[model samples]
Target: MSIKKPLDPGQEAVSLCQHHPREELCYSCSDCDGSLACPECVTSTHQGHTLVKLKNTPDFVWKKLIEHYIQKAEKFEIPKILKELKFAEGKLEQNRKHYQELIGVVQQRGEELKEAIDRITMRHVNTITEVAKENTVYIEYYQGELHSLHTEIIYALRKCHQANDTEDFSVVLDSEKIIRAGLKLPRVPITQTTKYRMGPSPLPLLESAFGGVEIVGYRPKQLGPTVPHVVQKKLEKPEPPKPALYSVVSEFRHLTDITSLVPTEDVYSWISNEEKKEVVLLDRAGDVKQTTGLSLHIRDICTSPITNNLWCCSEYDYSVREMTTPTNTEVRLNFPFVPRALALTHNEDVVVGTFRKVCVYNMEGEEQFMASADKLGRQIVASPQHISVCPTSGNVAVVDWDEQSHDGNGSPCVTVLTSDLQLLFQYRGPQTRALRSGKSRASSTRKNKKEPPPSFWPTDACYDAAGQLFIAERTSKSVQMVSNDGTFMRNLYTDQEFSPKTVGVQTGGFLWIGFDFGIVKVIKYKQ
Candidate 1:
């Protein structure tokens, strides 16, 4: 065959249509799965078929393939898979933490058991050693007695032999003394071997002492892609209307300002007057049930929910005292810093607010935790005036009055924190009324129209059964209700006549608002 010439650089090699050998393939038939066709074949064999130029067929095929893959990828459920992967990672992390905690518990218990076993082993060893020492002494005494008897018998026999050989009465008489000694040999000392027997193993008891692990099995019903069910939304029940302060049930007037108020489980309350340097228990009928005088000025007072014991702190003595009612017996707990505010948690632990720190103590006055700075190393409070612990959540809420604030505002704020002292949120006050009116503080100052809004000065705060905080706002002359999350809900009661200095909530929906003028009003609340 003649050698085919190499194609030029600028020219492309062409294939001839099978149907028409002379004609070059000029197009591709889409309906025929991209079969090659020439002009003659296109008109005859591939008539009425979708055709693409052979030059453009490769790009068209590539685009169609890409589109097909795009649809497939969209239906692959990749997002759901990624979410499941993240959930699994989180679960693994939780498992790690839980296992670590369990391991620590097991190790601690094991150490305790080891100590107990060591003590028991030492005790048993000592007992056996003492018994062995006594047995050794007895064995030595018995050996000496046997040696003495053998010597006596040998002496007596020697004396008798001399008497027989010499036929002398003197030798025989001497042998009699020896024989008497041999005959009088101490009765064979009764000896008993001391044997030690191992007691039953304590392995089973120890296993129960430390506790056993529980194995729980979890089975997933379906592993992979499943059709999600269409769940109908359930109607939520409407919340009951919040109770309003209908009327004053009873009002008690004091000669001195009431610095703190604590309602008790009984139909009485404990009120402290710093000026009077005393705390009094008042009945529902505004009668003084009992009065307790303090040597030092009382800064704040609270009552234990469990024991109903009165607890008060003194800034003068730098101490917290628990007073058992009726007997008036006092138990003093000393602290490094002066305690200004006092509260008792639902668990009967003491919560003390000092200059700039909050401390927790058990009933015996052992400090469990002290919180002065936050995780960021920033001081949490400048001056804590009052403290309250949420009965439900155990959150500590403090009325922080910053007299020496960096900004020199000297405004009081309410700071809420977890039991571990993690900062939650701080409430300065609600949005200024001017701000609600679309007026800025800068605008007001520039126009000289009105003074900026007054700063919030909270005197005290307490939580109700619903976990809502009732704050005594000295500047606003109102008892404000705040949600547990620190949002200002509404003013529970506002009085232009008196400034509330302290607020307390009692069982059966009663609000005890202590005013600056030494007036305590018992208002019945609906909620």
Candidate 2:
């Protein structure tokens, strides 16, 4: 709880030397061995050696050092210490509350178990009482029969005794003979009730009743030490001053009518003309390795993140099929709308962008959700040309091109939607200087006729691991790299004959772009 008072800046900067009374210790000689040498010593033996004036040095350095200490105290050091103390106190309070709550829960559970046990004991007791009553009835009936038999015997004995007392020898003898003939123990049987006691406790009975209390816990994770400035600067990647440019490294010719391009672990797979009914997987050398045939006309194809199979969308049948092997095809889903663009998400879900809506489906082809309208009930997608999922954010991005709008002056734009079909960001790429300067659309078009168009009509889109989007502009024959949030990052590729239509990022930093002339270009953009 103690705090050190700060030093005053107005204090004297230079102090006087203890040995020299007249001069201050403002200057020192480098040659003087471990002793504070005055100006006289500097002029005597250490004239040639290096000498520095302590007072001549900037006072700001000392001031800055003091300020840095204060800054750390006020900003980092003191605050961090206080935070640790507060956190410790909070943990103690939380532990106390948790202990009380746990006890309450245990007591409540015990009471419930006790009630159940009492009910079970009472049921047994009731059964025992009823059985005892039934036994008593049976015993009473047998006792009554025995009593009647005893009465019959007693009456006979009394008659015989009276005959003997009256001196009637003949009658007494007759009675005795009759009594002897009839004399027999009562034949009524008596029944005994068996005793019972409550049995021993079952071994697992307590465990089953209470479920054995368990304490599960979690504590906030402690953060690692703050990175030093020198180390952090090295660790952090410097943002490109201007976006980096991509150059063509290689090209594959002869694949005609290429529509979709996808790259895998060791090869690049692409779909060309539907009439061929085949998807070609090419090695790094652009040599055909495997050709998988499909029955339907494939519009787009992406590598499934789950099965690592080739997932193809047929625009003709509006069907989604998974090409498990080279010859095996599993029809997963048939959609009402024609699926145009397809992208496999990190979670292995298939994201399809159709004519008017963006739909998400699992690998089984079950429709999960759709983003057809915006928050204002306005149609969000018009003609979705391409779809890509941001790996970092899991956001589904769709490029919609409406050719019929504004008399075909429609500028294609990108729409980013959440996994749950909620809108995140929609942008029409970067604004042009002509548009920003309040120029008319016609004038701007005329002015930019000779130059590359300010914005591109999105033909295809794909995202890299760094969350950068590579969009193919068919008109300009170029591919632009954009940020996940729709900021224009850089032009990835522009070519005269290629006319990039669809693009894909490969294992390394190589880009596979399919062009209008059935050419596939593999370009390296990053190390």
Candidate 3:
């Protein structure tokens, strides 16, 4: 409870404790709330207290303060603010460009609609005019016949009057001729009146055609607090447990040439065969729920997350069909190129993989975006055979193959892209050493001497609940699992006899895999 007086600028840099005015202050007492103490004060008033020597305190305190300042300046205060500013500026520029493009699209669509309206109006006008002209021609011919009959009647009447006065017999004969002409009066042309039948207003349709804009709020990147060098050296986090196949849950047979398999929220899956042009819905117990026969051969099939409607792709007709029931189906979209794969995103957007591009469409069948090439204008995919969308991240994964390779199998890779169509990464199988290490020695040595190890030919892909990608490799006869960040994690399953053609991951940790020989095996997995 002592009050120390402030020292003057000219005063010496040494202080005496208030209680011990004769003794110099040489210690700071922690128990007394960091109060300065003299040797006599520590022993008498603040005994058994933690004390820091005043002579040694300057180095430790000043050094800590300097380090804190340096860290704030280097890590958070200066660099973070600068980076955030740059990011905001870049975002603004991107927004400007995006809106500008939208405006251009609206203007172009307006012009096209106007031109179409004009053409339709002119066509209707011409049709009405032509019909009116034909009707007028018939009316004119009838009027001419009536005029001729009137003239004959007038002549016959004048001749009859002369015959009455001068006794002429020829006048009666002329009257008879006039009567015959009048009896053959031309049949009155029954002209049907033409009028315009107006249709419903196009306001609602126009509003849908010119889709509304979606404004997404900007979210700044979050940065963690800067840690000191000493505190940063902590134990590493343990790796996540690798996924393992627990058991074969079920086996489905009787379906021929199963090209695609899509699992629904329930214990059911939809499978299709291109050769038979049939789509069958079956439960986990291998019981067929429904069967649908389509005219167009199905290339792939996917179920909507929201409505659970089946979306089927037809390569032969270059179209996609949406089926609500076994008998109710409608053409969802028609593409210029063949649609090889189909997938529905978390938002229920339809994703179709074609010859060299993947296109994303809203449920209304309007194109939202497309990805075919990289930012550098280089071709990203020669042929997108299969497509999958991550449920959590909305990221798109395409199994692309080089269709023009010397061997028909072609080199295949999985191209991962962000929801916005930005390129994330491409995974071209794992290293050869990693593959060999996974196989047993006997299996590795049993390979044909002439035939080398088959190359990676990914045919289909799907994302698990944990965002891990499961890709089915046709030539390798294995299903590869990739981490969310595009790292090759490991092989989930391998079969030496049958090649994997398609893969589907259900909600309850079940993986449904389809082979080329029309067999589907459902396996339960654990992480």
Q: How do the residues 1-527 of candidate 3 rate in per-residue lDDT, one tens digit apiece?
A: 24446588776556777777778888877676466789998789889999988778888764664676687779888988999999999999998998899899979988988898899999999999999999999899889988997787778788878888989777678487665555566688878688563443356577887677776797444324464645444433457896556678987665477777899887889888777777898888778899887887788888887788999888788888889777878987887878887888867778888776888988677899988766656555667777888876888898877454411134457878788777777777776322111122113232233444447778899987667889998877888888777768777888878999888999888999988777888888775
Candidate 1: give its CA RMSD in angstroms: 24.5
Candidate that scores best on lDDT: 3
**Candidate 3 global CA lDDT score:** 0.77
Q: TM-score of model 3 relative to the true fold?
A: 0.49
What's the number of clashes in each of the models? Answer: 0, 0, 0
- Give the TM-scores of the predictions, in the order they appear: 0.50, 0.49, 0.49
Candidate 2 lDDT tens digits, 244-337: 5666678767556777778885556655565567888776567887787777678777887556788888878888888877789888888888
Better of 2 and 3 by TM-score: 3
Candidate 1 per-residue C-alpha lDDT over 304-323 given as tens digits, one digit per residue, 9 for 90 to 100: 87778888888786888878
Best-to-worst lDDT order: 3, 1, 2
Computed on alpha carbons, the lDDT of every model, listed in order, comes to 0.76, 0.70, 0.77
What value of lDDT does candidate 1 attain over all alpha carbons? 0.76
Evaluated against the true structure, the overall lDDT of model 2 is 0.70
